[model samples]
Target: MAIDFGTCFTTAAVRVEQAGTAASGVVVTAVEIENSRYLPSLVCLDDDGRLLTGRAAVQLAAQRPERAESHPKRALLRQSAVLLDGGEVATAELAAAVLARAADEARAQRGGTEPVRTVLTHPADWSPGDLDRLVEAARLAGLDAPELLPEPVAAARFHAAEVQAEGDGPIAVYDLGGGTVDTAVLRREGSGFRAVAVAGDPDFGGRDLDQALFELLRDRALDLDPEPWQRLWGDRTPASAHQRSQLARELTLAKESLSSTGTVYLAVPGYPEPFVVQGGEYRAAVTPALTASIVLLERTVARAGLTPAELGAVVLCGAASRTPPVADLVAARLGRIPDLAADPKAAVALGALTDPPAPAGVDTGADAGEEAAQDAVSADGSRRWTVAHYPDEVDPELWF
Candidate 1:
C-alpha cells in the first residue's frame, strides 16, 4: 500500500499479486474513500472528542472554525500543535489521524488486517526529525515501522516506467504540490535510482496560487466596501473564518477550471457580486510563485551536476503541475516538454509502489511481524509488494 498524504489531498494504492506468479507482476489499484479514490487530508475534532478525517473533517471546518486543521503537513515543519475543538493537538497526532484513515481504507480494500510491508513518502529534503515524526505517526496509526521514500524519487520512478525513460543522464522531477515545490534529480542506479541533488521552496505551492486568486477577489471587494471586506477577510473571527473557507472553496474550483478554460467565474461569498477572473489575470497572479519554483528547479539541476539539456526528461508531479503556467515554464526552461503521461496527483503513489527507496522485502501473505514468501516483482523486474504512507489530499476544489 502506498499512501500519498498530500497537503491538500490524500490517496492510497495497493499492489496486489497472485501467489507464485512472477509473470502476473503486481496490480496497483487506488483505495477508495466513500467511493472516491482521494481523501481530503483535513482533520478535525468533534465536540465529543472523536477525530474526524477527510470529508467528515472538512464538513466540520465551517461549524467549528478553530478546530479545523487545514494543512497538517505544513504544521509538521513548525513542530507545533494546532488549536482544535478548544484544545491543542500535536501535528504528528494530526498526521496520525490522517494515516489511520488511510490504514482503515487499506484494510477494507485488502479484505483483512494481514501483515503487509508499509512504505511512506515524504518531501525529499525533510529533516530526520520530520521523518521520525511521520514514522511515529504511522506507529500511532497502528502500522509497522514504514520505510520512507522521497516524493521526487517516487515520481521519477513512476514516470520513468511510463515513458520507458532510459539514459545515464539523470531525470529531473518537478513536484509542485498544493503546499510546496520539491525538485530533485535522480539517475538510474542498477535496479533503482539515486537522488543526486534536491531543492525546494516550502513557502510556495498551489495554495499560494489559490490565495492569489482569493486576494484578487478580496481586493475587488475592498474597492467596493472596505468595512465589509475587512469583516470577512481579516483576522480570525468566526464569520471571517467561515468566509475564508467559503472563498477558498470557490477559488479552488475557479483555479481548476481556469486550467482548461480561458476564464473562470467566482461567486464571492461575503460580497454582493461575483467576479470573472480572466485566464491572463490568474496567470499573472501565479507568475511570481511559479517563477520561484522554476528558479529552484534550476538550482536543483545545477547542484545535481547537469544542465537542463542533459536531463532525460522533466517530469511533472503533484496537482499544481497541471497549471498551465507551471507546465509552460518547465517546457521553456528545460527545452524539453514536461511529461504529463501520469496523473499528476497519482504519480508519486504509483512510483512509491514501484521503486521504493529501501529494499522492502515482499509480504507474501506474511503474518504481522513475520516473514513469508519471496518478494513479488513487477513484470519489468522491479521489486514489489511494498506498502507506503505517502501523503495525499483533495485538490481544494474537491473539498466542497
Candidate 2:
C-alpha cells in the first residue's frame, strides 16, 4: 500500500495481483476511504484531547474552528507542536491521525490483513528532519518503518508508466497541490529515475487562489450590503464560524466549477443571495501566481543544467493542476503541453506502487545490497527510498 499525505487531501493505493488468470500481473488501484477517493487532510482536537480525522474532523472543525488544524502537513513544517483550542498537540500526532485513517481503510479493504509493504510520498524538497517526523508519524499510525518516496519522482514514474515510454533527457514534474507548488527535474538512471533538481513555493498554491476568489466575493458582498458582510466578519459565535466554513467550501466548489463553466454562483454567509463570479475574472486574479509557478519550473530545469526544450516530458500532478489556467500557463511558458495524469491527486500514491528506478552505478543482479539498491526496494520486494539517502546533495534551504 502507498499513501500520499497531501496538504489538502490524503490518497492511498495498493498493488494487487489479478486472480484466475495465467498472467496474473500486478495492478495498482486507489483505495477509497469513507466512500471517497480523496480524504480531506483535516484534524480536530476533541474535548477529551483525542484527535478526529476525515469527515468527523471536518464536521467538528465547522462547529469549533479553534480546535482544528486544517493543514497539518504545513503545520508540521513550521513547528513540532500546534496549540489548538488551548491544548498543545504535537504536529506528528496530527499527521499520524490522517495516516492512521488511511492505513486503517487500506487494511479494511484487504479483509483485515496488514499491507505487506507501505510507502509514503512526500514533497521532494522535504529536509531530513521533515522526513524523520514523517517516519515517526507513520510509526505512531501503526506502520512500522514505511518507505518514503519523493512526490515528484512518483509523479514522473506515473507519467512514464502511463505513456510506456521513458523518452530522452530528464522529465520535469510540476506539482501544484492545495498549499504548495513543487517543481522537480528527474532523469532515468538504469531501471529507476533520479532527482536532478527541485524547487517550490510553500506560500503559493490552490488555497491562495481560493483566497483570491474569496476576496473577490468579499468585495462584492461588501458592496451589496456592508452591514451583513461586516457582521459575518465580526461575529465570533459558533453559528457564524459554521457559516463561514460553509461559505469557504462553497467557494471552493465554485472555483472548481469555473474550470468547466463560464460562471459560478457563491452564496456568502449573511448575504441574501449568491454572487456570480466570471471564470475570466477568477483566471485573471490567479494568472500572476500561476505564471510564477511556471517560472519556478523553468528555474528547476535550469538548475538541472537543462532547458525546457531538452525535457523529455512535463507532468502535472495534484488536483489543483486540473485548473484550466494552470495548463494554459504551463504551455505558454514551457512551450509544451504538460501531461496530466488520469487522477492527479492519486497519481503519486499509485505511482509509488510501480517499480522504482535503479540508483546509478548499482548492479541489478542478485547480489544482496547491490540488488536492493538497484531495485530501490527492500529484500521483501517492497519499494523503499528516502530523500535523506538520495545520492544528490539537497539544498537545506529548500526544505519546507
Candidate 3:
C-alpha cells in the first residue's frame, strides 16, 4: 500500500487480494475509509505522548483547548507553532503524530500487521534531506519508513489510466491539489513510463489561490497584509511565524463553489452578513499568476519537441482539480483535459497503488486493463516518481 500523505490532506490505498479470487489472482487497489481517509494533515499531542489524527484530533483540539494542538502539518510546513495544553510543539512533531495516527488506522484496516508495504508521496522538488525527514517521521508514527513517491508521478499513473484508454504521445499531468500545483510529462514505454522532464512551483497551487481569495476579502494590500496571508495561505513553503487557525470551513466551501457556479456565497462568523463573489472576478484576480502557470507547462512541452496536440492526455490531481481557471488553462494550452471529478484529491493515491504509468510510446487508443498486468512493470522497476534529474542543475518551473 502507498499513501499520498499530503500537507493539506492525506489519503491511503493498498494492493490486496481480489474478491473470491484464486491464489493465482489479486487486484491492486487504493482503499479509502469513511472520514478515515483524510484527516486535515493535523495532530495534537498530550504530555503522556498520546496522539490524535483525522477528525477526532481536530475536534479534540477544541475540547481539550490546552493539551490538544492542531495543524501539526501546517506547523511543520510553515515553521510555526501552536500553543497547546502541554505547551509549545514543533510542526514536524505534529506531522509525525499525524503519520502515527494514520499508521494506526492503516494497521487496523490491514489486520494489525507491520508487514504492510507503504509508499509515501512528497513534492517532486523536495530536498533529499526533506524526504529523509518524512521517512523518519513515518518511522516515528510506528511503521517502517515507506517508499517515497512523488505527487506528480502518482498523478501521472492516475491520469494515464484514464485518458490513455483512447489514444498516445506523452501524458501531461497538471496536479493542482489542496497544497501544491504540480505538472509532469511522461512518455509511455513498453510496460510502464518514464518522466522526460518535470516542473512545479511549491509556492503556487490551490493554497496560493486561497491566499488570493483571502486578500480579496481582507481589504488589505498584498504588501501590508502579505505576512498574515502568507501564514494562512503559503503553509507549504518555508516561512517564519505562523497562525495556527484553520481556514473557516465556510470560506473554503464558498471558494470551492465559485469554481463551478458563476457565484459563490460565504459566511464570516463575526460579520453580520454573508459574502457573495462572482466567478469572473475571482478569475481576474488570479489570472496573472495562472498565466505564468500555463507558460510553465508550455516550457516543458516545448522542451520535449512535442506540440500540445501530440500529448496523450492531460491528467489532473490534487484538491484544486475543480478550479475552473486551472482546467481552462490546461484546455487552452493542451487542447484537451481529462475528466477529474473522482476524489480529485485522492486520485493519485488511488492510481499510484493500482494504475501503473503508461508504457513509453504508448498508443493512447487502447484500454489499459486490456494490456497484461505484466505490462505495468518498468524495466528499471521504478515508478515514474523516481524522476532522474540533476536537481542541483535543472531549474525547470515548478508546475505541471
What lDDT does each candidate get? 0.73, 0.82, 0.62
Q: Estimate, for each residue in 1-400, the C-alpha lDDT of model 2 and write its tens digit.
A: 9999989899999888778898687889899988999999999988888999989999999999999999999998899999899878999999999999998998888888888788888877676667778888888888876777888878888877777454646799999999888888887655667667877777787889889999999888888889998998799999999998998899888888988999998877667778999999999989987888899888888878888898888999987998869988989888988888879889989998876444446565655334234324444333444444322334322211
TM-score for each of the candidates: 0.85, 0.89, 0.77
Model 1, position 220: C-alpha lDDT score: 79
Answer with 1 or 3, whichever has the higher lDDT: 1
Winning model by lDDT: 2
Better of 2 and 3 by TM-score: 2
**Candidate achieving the largest TM-score:** 2
Task: For candidate 1, write residues 1-400 as lDDT tens digits.
Answer: 8888888888787877766887666677677898877788888888887778977788789767778888888886786688776688988889889988987888788787653667677776665556667777777787666656678878887876667644445788889888988888776544566566776667778888888888887787778778866766566777667777877887888888888999887776555667778999889888877887888888878877789998878888897888868888887777778787457887887777773221234332335213211243433323332322221211111100
Question: CA lDDT of 370 in candidate 3?
Answer: 40
Ranking by TM-score: 2, 1, 3
Angstrom error of the Cα, residue 108, model 3: value is 2.2
Tens-place lDDT per residue, model 3, 272-300, is 45556689988888878877876777777
| TM-score of model 1 vs. true structure | 0.85
Better of 1 and 2 by TM-score: 2
Backbone clashes in model 2: 3
Q: CA lDDT of 6 in candidate 3?
A: 73
